[model samples]
Target: MQLTNLNMPVASLLACGNDPGVMTTEQAHAAMQLHLDCTVDRCLVRRRARTTLVEAGKCVLDDQAERL
Candidate 1:
């Protein structure tokens, strides 16, 4: 199932640029909804923004250590 269930529009071709801006999922969704008139996708936002990731073990161990 889709996150927002709105019809997603295809992203237009983008030229290579020296600088690109970044935004969060919520922010991207809002911008697309307002400007593009489509929800696009929650997952694609992360990929386009190059978000960071953490290993499951690292996250779980860090949380456990903090609680001790």
Candidate 2:
């Protein structure tokens, strides 16, 4: 059994970008709702942004330990 149903109209609207000619305000809203309903995926690893900050602190601490 398929767990998800596809909305062709919404899919068409979403593909149209923000063009007011092809997609209207209501259609944009429907597209937004469809986007929000999609599942988000995350990997089990340290994010690069946070890792850089953490590694910077580690390096500073290592330098201080070497000095002492």
Candidate 3:
């Protein structure tokens, strides 16, 4: 997936800076570690927001079906 397309929390975790067009393998690992290490309550809001963003993206894609 494109780093630039990532939502705010995920992009921040990758630490690829403001305009992250690409990410290194180490950055990917660190981001995953951070995600795995965080406690559920601490990450709950972020997780919820990410879920909402994903659902919204799906809706956008589903719009094409409605158009047809």
Give the Cα lDDT of each candidate.
0.32, 0.32, 0.41
Candidates ranked, most accurate by TM-score first:
3, 2, 1
Query: In model 2, where is the ten-residue run with the lowest total lDDT?
Result: 40-49
Candidate 2 lDDT by residue in tens digits, 1-68? 11123323333433323222333333333443444543212211112212333344532335543343
Which residue runs does candidate 3 get wrong by more than 4 Å?
1-11, 14-21, 37-68
- Backbone clash total for model 2 is 0
Lowest summed lDDT over 10 consecutive residues: which window, candidate 3?
14-23
Backbone N/Cα/C clashes per model: 0, 0, 0
lDDT for position 51 in model 1: 29
Question: For residues 1-68, could you state the per-residue lDDT of candidate 1 as single tens digits?
Answer: 24244233323212122112454344334433443432223334432333211221212235543343
Model 3, 1-68: lDDT tens digits are 54444444464563322332333444443343445655324554334333343454522325543342
The regions of model 2 sitting more than 4 angstroms off are 1-21, 37-68
TM-score per candidate, in order?
0.25, 0.26, 0.27
lDDT of 3: 0.41
lDDT-wise, the better of 1 and 3 is 3
TM-score, model 1 to reference: 0.25
Task: Report how far off residue 65 is in candidate 2 (Å).
Answer: 42
